[model samples]
Target chain A: METLTIQGSPKTPTVEMDAKSGVIEIKGRSIPENSIDFYKPIVEWLDEYASSPSGETTVNIKLEYFNTSSSKCILDVFKKLELVYKKSGEKGVVINWFYEEDDEDMLEAGEDYQSILKIPFKMIELEE
Target chain B: MTFDIEAWYGEINKGDVIVNHKGVITNDLITEILSIVENKLIERKENTRIRKKIYNVMVEALQNLFHHTDKLPNETNDNFGEKFVTFVLKKEKEDKFSYISGNYILKSRVKFLKDRIDQIKYLTHEELQLLYKLILNNNEFSDKGGGGLGLVDIAKRTGNNFEYFFHENKKDHCFFCLKILITN
Candidate 1:
């Protein structure tokens, strides 16, 4: 498991997924023109990492904004992680969805994703 | 020509919804628009599931319009430049908000635009997501432009297929009106 670090641009978000560290973070705006293209590698990385089977994985999603396509890509990422969580048979996957306290849209979006996926997702408020 | 834009807007009797125009489509304006549209989705008295869908669709549509508008090359000022963009949100008889966008486009670009829109309209949500992933996965095609997948994004978010009308202008340019009506 190697560390994959991608810097976020004005149109895309920063993605840092370290299979070794078991700390995956996706932040910033993600209105990419090709969201599937942008997320494909990330999803593939997670799939590959699942083979190694980390004891515990924490995926932190802190997106300020993302398009519908990007949202689906995010869902795909979660879906893949959920697979790992089920198969690992260790503990499970810890997913934290962070959003600004005042941003009702972000909070609601996190809740929506949480309800759809089977993973144990905790929607937390960011005081900042 | 002092086009009575308000007069046209006032004729519709869906409901009273007002948009605050900052005279420019800056970051602040985008945020304002997003907030207003999100509030509008809630005010529609829709179920939480439908409201969330509408909110996501409208956000994607507006972001596409803001980011993809034809830009003048090397203009020091970004937002202050000519912003001939239109965003029309209307509630239909079925309580769905039709998120619409109209903007100036080069006359020569209509064929490609029409073809792209047609391709997207035909794709199902899963197919669109797969296509979007395929495009994102391939990096060699970056030189062409990044907007190829934006339409796919819009298609997935928008529950309905896209509608377009090309309005010819006297200045030889044309205004492409794009619309997607998402039901709550």
Candidate 2:
């Protein structure tokens, strides 16, 4: 039960996760200068957390932009969470993607991710 | 056959604007522009939501140019010399802001470009997402076949179709221009 936080740059987003609270939030842009470097630690943390994962894990993602490389990494993160969900069985993971009302791109981005990942993901629209 | 010198110069200058944008279009330029835009965004009292939208739109445009630009750097083969890509931020009469980018691309690629644009224009936002997923989940990206779903995302940036034009170059290339409008 711990917390991990990393700030995102012009290319990425700030990542904040609280193991005890079971709240994992990824917010901001995601065009990182080095996608592998920025995401390695986050993915590792998720891997570690998945071993003895908490109940009712909620992963919130609010990304404005990400490059093709970063998009791959995000998919990796979701895949990892999918593993966690399978392990937990019935009490699996819940994913929420927040996008502005007018931002059809981001909304569609959420849908794309939703279609690929096995976990339950809800697309939430926030007013600008 | 002699090269058309006037047409050559015109082609070179089609999208060339010699202005110092504090290096707004380079790897070094992104840092400065990001901070300035973030600041301007704060001053306008825009929340994180709107701010992120603007930020993503700008990044998509810049990276598209950075990765796709065909022109060489500082090679003065043409009369206008090696041209630089540009970003012009303007505030119009209705207090609207615009971010525009222009670059040179190979004439040989126009058909591919046109087909992609037309395909995206025909898909609904939801359909575009499904197509993007199918492509991302199945396709492999090669230098030759760049069959990624990124352009659909770019078209989604406007929540509508994008604007673009081409100017024939005297050389074997054409200057491709993309203009995106994100309304506040």
Best by lDDT: 2
lDDT by residue for model 2 (B1-184), tens = 4334344434434432221131124556665666677778777676665566566666666666656767643443443444446565544323244556666677888778878878887778678766667776663554622336557666665565467767775366776766665655
**For each candidate, what is chain B's TM-score?**
0.74, 0.72
Model 2 lDDT, residue A116, Cα: 84
CA RMSD per model (angstroms): 7.9, 5.2
User: Model 2, stretches more than 4 Å misplaced?
Assistant: A1-7, A16-23, A33-37, A44-56, A62-69, A98-108, A122-128, B1-24, B41-52, B73-83, B92-97, B139-147
lDDT of 1 by residue, B29-132 (tens): 66667678667666666566555556566666666666555543344234535654666666665556666666656677778888888877888766875676
Q: Candidate 1: which docking quality band?
A: incorrect
Candidate 1 pairs with clashing backbones:
A36-B133, A37-B136, A37-B137
Error of 1 at B175 (Å): 0.6
